[model samples]
Target: MSTANTSNNTDSAIGAPVSATLPTLSRQDRDDSRPQQYPSPSSPHATSATSPPIPTPSPRNGRAGYQLSLPIPRLQRSEWVNLEGLVECALSSLGKDECTGISELGRGSHNSLYEIRFSDGTSCAASISNSPRQFFSADAKRSEIATMQYIHSSKLYKIPIPKIYSWDLTFDNKVGAPYILRECVKGKNLSEDGRFYRLNARDKQKVVKELAHVQAELSKPSEFTQLGYIYRQEGENGQFYVGKMATVPSGSDEEDKMRESFMGPYDSLTELWEARIERETLCAIGNWSQLPSDASLPSMLPPAKANPQQFGELQQLLSGLTNLFTPPEQLSKLCIHHSDLAIRNVLFDEKTLKITGVIDWEFASVMPLVITGRFPNDLGWEGNEFARSLGKFGNVSDGGVWNHHYYDWTSLSGVQPPPRADMPSPPASPTHSPASIDYLTTPNATANGYLFEHQASVLEDFDNSEGRAPSPPSPPLPPPPTSETSQQDLTSRATNLVELYYYRKFYASKLAARNFNLTRLFIDAVAYIKFNEIVLGGPEKWFASADWIKEVYWRMQEEDESAREDLMEGKGVVKVPEVFLAVRRREVDLGKWENKVMSMR
Candidate 1:
């Protein structure tokens, strides 16, 4: 690869035009010019606005001039409920309770969490959903409550889950949003000591067994006609009926828009699989501009309309992989699945190696057993390595059944994992430091914590949502591909890994059609390549009609290399990294009907 020259389009951070040769400031000089680091957890600045502003390199608009500042796109500000109002709402749920203490737990794209304590020493957590989406609707919230209540009632697994004390799904109350108050699970997250790496072999083995049992219980066949989200609906006579998601998901509206009509509690696995693909495609196209931006991404050049032929090729690639996962004839068993089963959602008594609570069931649904049998993602995840592993063609293997240690839990007879005698250490002591236990448990991906929740949180939060104003759909969907076409896509010599190639091709065309900013496109492309380098073996794709893509890829790689060099010398600018998890489709009502319910109230 030839060295990249930035003389034509790129300018320095200070707005000075750059020469063909790159700047060569001393490491110390670069370090001095770099942005200030986040303050220590104990420092007042750590948790307050006193800290330095997040660096926004060249946050310029339009497609004309380009500068080489960090490419962190602006965060879209969404409507959030007042913390004081939220506190009052939680207190009201408890009926004449006196609030002794309260603190903001955390906030995600759609929900804000708060922990409340009453004078009677009773504590509970309030999860208030704001700006609900198709994936995180009132129905999804209701499903979560029903699932947790069911689990607690069934006593199926030895593990425990938080008990719901109160819930309001209609937002008919003063809170004006769906809120749930539940028992505050009192244990450290399983990842408190650095994920699985920090756990002893005994602890690891113990956790695996316990989790397997929980899996078995959830997978047990129950009274259900088809596969979909599980929710509780109260009838006119005051009887609550448990069944499929209150609203099945249809791939036709903006993810944030709630609708009454959806696909189904499919009778066949193939039908469900097709619905899943349709939902994803619709979401990507419909919510392109609503996604979030990443701080570390490099901006893209002005995107031009992609050629129909190129777009068609990309479509063929996507269809290929979609079919690979969605078998046509095989009827897979369906069962309840915790779609987002990661370490952060699992609370543990580390000393005793016992699971305290399993939280966050918004994405829970009844789906094919293969979907649930795959090992928990946290099993082998750790930073960039996890990304690299995804790209490794050799790693392309079928999912396996959960490893059973104690009993033949595969039968789903509500059996528990073997009991152990180990006693758990006391919870970490309270501290005023910003990194205290409270802040640590917030599900987020930052330098300080595990990135699983961070990944799960950012699915619809795409990086270029606003940086590039979306254009009209360029090329319409082509005829679906046949089995032979899919086979060709997988066997392509350019990349042995079929999955990575198809995703890259599909997104490239999709973004181009939407007129994604050129610089941002380059940044996203390179990051994808770097993270999945092992899978692709190397970045080589003949199907990419946008020639500028290769150039930007090389340039961004060069810039990243330079930044790393400066980082080693303690003087280079560092971009805040971002993670993307697959979008989980479950039943959620964005509020069309809820609004009607509120109106009646």
Candidate 2:
């Protein structure tokens, strides 16, 4: 990483640029593709009389400048941002005399990050939310600061959280935007670190174990009675309290807009669901009427307006399914969850692979343990197509079954198994095949058994010694060991599959050993549904079929019955289709969709 300051401004903040010493850029830094220059603070762009333009860095390479772009016209603003003012605010907060330089660190969906270096050799990260509407609430910045402070002060978890030095929730400050200045966590994001993917199965398991432990610790304090955003109360010694749930902004600048920005600190999960459904219903109806016929709508919005009565029907259906969405009493308690636990949000040491800090708590909120508990996004088998294919054979938690299936195929085909110390011994009965192994006896297995058997048959096709006629699967199998499809490629794929199985198995076991209740909640089907609903918007937006409302109602009924039977029989777990657990796919698809829409804009 380049330590030299990238900012062009000299001693004076928000003043004419002056000549200063510049560091030589490394080859890597010189080749970096992101825009590097910050717009001059003294730019001649006129500011709105009512609200000054939020300063943003402009690209000198003639590319589109980094700015908050939204579908809402009223929320769109100029790309010019007061970078010098932001640096000055950070310096003032840290009690620094002079700034060495400021450089853009990165940009996320909602915030832009910068690293500001001071003359004293100290640096801090500033996360600036370019638009208050990002979170659909004005209190987004304040709530985030409060959440970070509460977690940092509590010291209840082993994971490191950044310390907030200062923050502004409004554009009243010189920064001209809401920003949080905090200690710069001295580590690289786990996702950005290439070394992580190169680790052996055992080492990868260690990382997964640590992440699971962090999640277990976060679930320790689950006594919160209300489901909402945490906020710090007013006064000199104000305490944190669970407050209204943040929702979409009403797009009104009036006083009532603030009130509408949040919905409720619901007493129960049902109430929260009801509030959410109602909000989405209204938003859908409003969008249907307001948007032009030819205008492109975000995926979250309905494609076309339904019968006015259908909206009510959808709301009622969701309202009645609340119980199905609710977990058992033990797992119903609310706990703080980092809803977006992507690898990019996690910081870790490159040498030891120990997690240093977790950032981006803007979306963190109190929610039911069932909904909060799950494997972190990076640990899930969503992005890797091979891993996802393996998932078709069994549940993610059934690592032993996957291992057995892999070994069964490799043994029959006379292929050597990958060198893995963690690989479990094959099934005791050598004759046991994927079709015969009863890893899960639940209805879920029966529902997906055919797919599993089909995959098993395809693997059998690789072996011809039995003289059985080959029945290849739809996705054609690789031709026999060509240069392009060598044994090494097959072995590599098998290794990846085995590693994912072990990683998930280890993660689940770690959660169970640390907190069994959390493990139970982690696998709860209804909880995954609720989590997906939050991420991909309401179920209404999930499909284009007009019968989606009806489909959701029927599916909930079936799940509810299955859950009841499992509990009655002491099984204690509700299993659903793999599609419900495909969170990574939904998230990735949404990102791509959003980016496409943004480009169109």
Candidate 3:
């Protein structure tokens, strides 16, 4: 059918709640001035020469509430849709027709959002999967829709989630794509809103507290018996069930094979970790037969070929560590968690500073609590200058006191000590009066002076027998403030630093207070180690160096001891050692280096 005729038929057939007088574009308008075409970059059917060029929205356009248009590549030809078909399906889903507007909201890594406004002033968002690879497949979409619906229907979870209106898992529908049409959450994304930073410390604390509450709720145990994605049965009121894991595509045919082989509803954490390691290993070493005819080995494998033997050894190491950390009781249950909890995924009212909704559930999955439990990324101030300044002031322990010797008050207060030579000497003793000292200075009196000096030296030699250096003079107290303005500025900065520290502390405390297990799982060092081994190629890339391995192993042992002590004491928070942080920094740098090398190929 013609696009316009299809829209008209949809409006009349559905009896949509849209005005009958809504305008329709003429044939000329439809052909010349309709929204621009966005063809998939990987599609064989590229736009013809007569078609208009693709649109490229500037960065500023995104900030101005316009979509950041970009070419979205599709993994299969069936996942293609025309604008008219998209609008028609969206209208049918909303039970509305003759919509006032259909505008692109934004495009993400795996999907694109479009805002569909109707004549009655109501609006809904349609999220269409742009890539149907291993991660954004039809199964993944089904799981995401089921998850959102389950959360929306359950009264146990007080977290604000957008209501799902309709969803399609097949590409044969009118939309010609797997999609979910849901309520258009009203409010700016928390990360994009500047009002959050300007709030008073109390209000800011409240924000983090609420976020913590939401996270705690999400980490609650589920009825599932395995680790995987949630899927609903094929009925109007179907029951949700655990299904195969949804994973990211590695942009290679080997990734497809690996996913089919390793994706599972695993019975144990060890099984899951092993499957992940195996997948990463094989995908890193791409399938030679599946490579394009013209592609070179370097283009697929990057720096060098991967050693399967090394991957096997790494898997064994991870297996041992996973067993060490995984409690037997936790293996039988799973908890659902948002894949990414950054501020960008959070919507909040600017006036009340309350979270209105949480969006982007395509990657959410049901997994072991240890894997699901994590602090919200927004509360972290890892690379902030203020956080660094606070760290220099002192390391705050779980008890909310500066316990360790990490404090450098002199540096924080910006005070410089006077030179050693300028320090005042003690007054001369009565036995060695000034006049007696003058006589000692005279050349004729050198014999007595030499004998006295030698006698004093004997005592000094006795004092130095232990080979300890003499204690240095103490620094003077800081001088009085130069101005009230400077004092106010210092106070303001100090207050900000304190707030930053406590915001994270408060979040950890909330989780710990509910159940120390949550905190334990959140900071589980074994999980980080596994991530390094599988995702970052830690075993093959860095573990070969004896010094690197030794440092990481030592840090791991220290963390293990500290974790044990904290558990015994029923403490929720464990201060990470500086050595671990240094190691993570190195890992981050290495990841960047690897990316750079890959780009060069």
Candidate 4:
């Protein structure tokens, strides 16, 4: 929909335990013109060739919002939406006389939003997906619509979720691009007001309490029937698929292969996790099976310092983790998580600190508590002691303090959670509230006989380690002596290993994308080992140390570039551009700093 889209960077990888961020609402320059009649739906007309020019927002403003209406410079290849066509389509669909004002609402990596006010003073938001290269897919748009519809139908949460009036998945709908029209939820976004950090402790706590209660409501297990994307099936008799894995078109022949199966709406959380683990394992071993005959590691590798014994130990540990978390019995319970609860997505009134709405449900999914238990990464603040002290500013779910607020609110609001079928009856303790017990403990604790206290400790340690922040906690790597580990040990180790694997995989993917040749590093044993070692340090440490790895890669990159230059010079080829030559010299300097890091290590 044409709702605000936050541009904050957030983790939204499938099956990854990362937080999400959406687009932010940018302040708009008020249009001086009076309200105009809404375009008639019966005889819609797009702006003429000489239609009065739409005023573009000035760039002098510090905040650019999501999409800058200013035409991107010629060399910039970023996708741009056909806003004129979208405006015409939206106005036509609404059947309003003519829009009084249509202004850029926000922009995000994948979509751009515009607010359209009808002559009658009513308005709606329009979200147009960036064509040719969309961050989100057709299935994702469908799932988002389904999520909002489902949430609206349930009336489970007190905060407002915008209602989706209509949507066009493909440009075939005369809009020339995919767009969603929904009710324009009024009230300034928290980011726009820049008032989040200004609230009093009492108000901040109130926001946290409200957030926790909303989380509790969203996480109801009974509401979702299965694990996967939600959508409505085709045909007149098509049924709504709440928990079905969605499939979408892929590859060059998008139309013919439209029926092709994509990944899945996994049957269980274990199945989804295994699919990811298996995919990454392939990047390491290539096509070689784990047969004794193929005992040697692949040869497409560079020499490294990793010991074979340690490599084998880690590999075994990772494998044990895959098997350990594979079974349903050992898995945690599943529930829907917003997945992207960053500040941009949260809407609230600064006066009361009461949240008015939470937007962008596109990434919402049914995931395990292990994935959804922590606060969003974007919400983490390590250096700012003042921000950390406020329950709303720092991680709300930290230390179970937010959980207490959530429980208290649930009790006061009379929002009863459906009984967890898996939880065991606690020893008679009148003091322990069921909500408190439920919030603190996990399904794994109940199923595996792990103590509630132990579950809390592990989850907290885990959030501290893998979660993003200025200086995340060092990975609480399981105590030494990797031999003779138990199931619980494997579980603990597996969680970290999974987190580490994804962490390295994310960077590795980035390197490959930036320097296509670096993809060869995946086969380079030395590179692979160093990459894992980096992530093994946990999020903060790994991120801090990443410059070293990038330096080595870039040095090798510059060397290759220099060799290319020499070949061209020897062949009497054209001289290289001074700009290119200067860039190479700077790269060489960067390599020196990277070398320093290695020397110290």
Candidate 5:
């Protein structure tokens, strides 16, 4: 999913929100691509949940052609062929009033979305997925449903997530795919409705705060189906088990022992997601290129012998062997996920500006644990990426070790693209260069058919406080000293946010690292660096302030050979090379400054 970005820094976290001095959005652009039909299927919210008929909003600006309905016949597939039947069953389970209409919304990389409206006009969302195969296995699908169910069943899970009105599967399909249905969630999808941009800073901050809460709650994994928060403790056995009094329900002693060995603590929702990704990534690596991924990293990890005979047997039935590996010890492993936890997937009220709901579930999964920072530019506007190499290659333990590949925003895209008409404003700006981003395509793997894994500190730090809240609405900010938000009570919230950044940076960096090209880092790191570039330049630069850039620029400029020599020796610094070129382009868009700098060359 490549996105075309705009110079809209409205949500660029380094500073306060302002009337965005944005490049014209594609909404106004003449798209020469194929005639796009934002086909909204007829899966409206179940009639049981409807509040009132929100007659399709009059076309914006009197544009009469945006139809609220697409004639594509619903439930055409033979497997999920009888949605009406499933709907009936769901209606029965949800107390016939739980549904109003099942209108189709759209689809994603893995599932089909349906809107379920109840009779009250209030609605929730529903999804009907094909046989959960490939990236989404049935168990994982069930797990997601279970995760949702966990939310619906808990008290702390008061994040406005859509409730599962009912879930049905025409189970006869290992033959095809399974069917899932949920209720419709109301409010403007900031991704879809442009009105969200009009929100005042107070509302935006409130939205972000609530988002942090939901994320934290979602990350807490409890034994019973609880969503938001889950407190846990070890049971009689030495194994880590989530028990009563404070935690959600746990499995039987046997199940607990078996799962506890690998899953780690189910104390938080993110911990579970993190644990799951580790196991999934662990099991995900299986001869994709068939060149034998594990063959090279033999000395890197523990030896696990897979039966060659067993491998030979499965090779016949499989296409791309993406193994769904089970965890050896339930408590030790975590999942690979978008550590970046922003309100990119949320919607807000047109009047109140309060968040309606959060959406994007694509990067949500059980993945490897070694991933540190995904998106390098997610940290406010300053392009900073961090990672935990997990000592896979060394004898070290834990994942906080740093492999310093310094330099800011030189590798990737500079200004971030504007928020898509279809997605919420992404939390971070990719301040890399224009050439390309150095993101990862494949999971890191090893010689014994193992994939490289790292711990995501995301879920563990999902809590939030005053600092994490959006800055108060004010006139554009005057330069201020750096305020430490390191302890913003962001327990799992920060961790999730970290994972998102980690994913972005990892893929972008790996993109650069792949061909052994350090420029790749520059390519992806550029957007981030550019944000910093603007930060360096201070207010003189529209994309950023001009003061910061001038400072960095002067720091790097060689005043004399002695000064350069001193910088080279790490003594008196002539300049900071970490300031990359891609970032300089942000506020210097006119090139007037660039040409003048070239004259100095």
Candidate 6:
């Protein structure tokens, strides 16, 4: 092979203009698109704003741009939420006298949620999601925090609301995401309340009116506050839209065929702010794992065992849900609404059929306001579950099986979100943002809506839901391929490992060579390697244990210089310093997520 190692389009960050790609949960189905990092030529101050001398424009648009992705920040904003004196303060602020005192229940996924009991023993639930790092900047994060702060400060009036006890700066640190605390109100998610459908027409009308009222609250701009992403004013009238983003992601083989502009750095926090209203002005766009299989689809469907009428009803629901993804003219509009609106993400009271608290508001971006589907239509099946849980930063919503909402809980606090239309036409140019989204003008057709009731605060009836279904039985998929596909998969996996190692070494070299600070470089270096591990199916899996990583140091060797020369020749392998051998042997968190889940749960 030639000695020349081709850098190809190795320029990191979103090179050239890239298209959007979905990061679907299922590994195979993830977005092949890339993130766009640099500004376009049209912007007045585009040249002066960015740093690192914006790398070369991508040679093309569709390539993974993994070669062109920007360096993952060593400084990823830590999701920090810490609260001091939140429970007492929240109770005092609500100023209600139902019982004697409140004790802390365990937390849900996002905020450290708590249930406050009154003197007479009535209870309410509250959640507070706040953190340091980019909460100082992330528009969506700020949006959630600010919106809750607004409602809490005003005692969340009008609808049955969770009294936001307070949103104060408790403290900050590297480990824990900082947080604010609020009371858990008495309510249940409408989706879970089967009793809701049993309500008389008059009761249903009252519910509809309450729902309308919630939407009305969201319609006005004041109830919503700035999410804090930077939006720059662009175009004829100098309209402001979403500008720079704080959580701008770096490209990864984690991406596929197309380039994704998901990650990058913010030019300024103001840019993050300006990004809110501004249309996609220029700079644009932009986690994990596991699986279990299930039975034949026939059994999975309700019709398999049901009579004709039941089968027809099931078919309609399936068709309606399926139809959500059909292409349309207008894309979902983005505005300030409850980000965590999943069926599982709510609280309620049984008797009155009221909504108590809306929890989990994490991935709350001002994107197309898709109203119909309870879950994100863009995400595949696996992603839908994740979106319900991990997407929001506000409330905690796990699958319905382990839920406590079935009791007499009512979620009175409601929301007003505009319905989603088809994917909007591409931006007039290469810019698009939430404000640019146009769902208001497009007519949306009515689809089936969910009917349910308030939750009663009784002990969980989990036994019914839990043991009802047997463990999923797997079916044989297509037979394994000849050695060919398997080899390709292995080769691809190995190549990824090599490339991961190469990039880490390359990045370290870049940092040291440029005289970047060791602190920043150190953080970036570790993270870069971790990102690579994700591609290599992870290091912990490969190494098996941390002890192995330590034990294997300097022991693994290339059998010959020819192998070394090959890895180096075409792939910049020749330049790799010997120190990387040592780097690979270093031990770090092997099963952070598993450990975290077990301990935290």
Where does model 5 exceed 4 Å of error?
Answer: 1-81, 95-100, 117-124, 131-136, 156-158, 169-177, 193-203, 215-340, 359-601
lDDT of 5 by residue, 305-347 (tens): 2223323222221111111111112221233232233434454
Q: Could you tell me every candidate's TM-score relative to the true structure?
A: 0.46, 0.60, 0.57, 0.48, 0.37, 0.29
Best lDDT among the predictions, by candidate number: 2
The predicted structure with the larger TM-score, 3 or 6, is 3
The order by descending TM-score is 2, 3, 4, 1, 5, 6
Question: TM-score: which is higher, 1 or 5?
Answer: 1
Per-residue lDDT tens digits for candidate 3, residues 1-601, read: 0000011111101111122111321222121211211111121121111111223222221111112112112111133654455555655544453344454444433455555555444556666765543334566667777888888888778788766777665666655666676666555443422335566878877677767777777878877787778888876678988888654444456545656787788886667666655665565455443544323422212223223433454455554444334443532246776755545456566567678777656557776665554445344322122222233212211111111111112223542222233443221101211111111011011111211110111323322221111110011112222223264655554454355555666776787776655655544533333332232222323223222333334455656676755533434322334222243223334477886887799
- The lDDT for every candidate, in the order shown, is 0.37, 0.46, 0.44, 0.39, 0.30, 0.27
Poorest 10 consecutive residues by lDDT, candidate 1: 399-408
Q: Give me the overall lDDT of model 6.
A: 0.27
Q: Alpha carbon lDDT of residue 331, candidate 3?
A: 23
The alpha-carbon lDDT assigned to residue 149 of candidate 4 equals 68
> How well is each residue in 1-601 modelled by candidate 6, as lDDT tens digits?
0000011111011112121111111112122221111111222121111111222232322322231133212111223432223323333434432222222332212233333333322334333332223222234334344444444444333444333333333343211443343433334444322333346655544444344344333323332233322232322233334332233112233321111232222332123222221222231222111112111211222222222333233323322222212112121223444433332344344456455445443333342222211211100111111112212112211111111011111121211121223532111101112112111111010011111111112112211221111110011011222223344443443343333233333333443443322213233222112211211111111111122222222222422655434432322111112112233343376877885796687
Error of 1 at 509 (Å): 42
| Candidate 2 clashing pairs, residues 3+ apart or interchain | 55-81, 55-82, 56-80, 56-81
TM-score for predicted model 1 compared with the true structure: 0.46
Model 6: residues >4 Å from true position, as ranges? 1-106, 116-141, 151-160, 167-177, 190-209, 220-334, 342-601
Which window of 10 residues has the lowest lDDT sum in candidate 6? 1-10
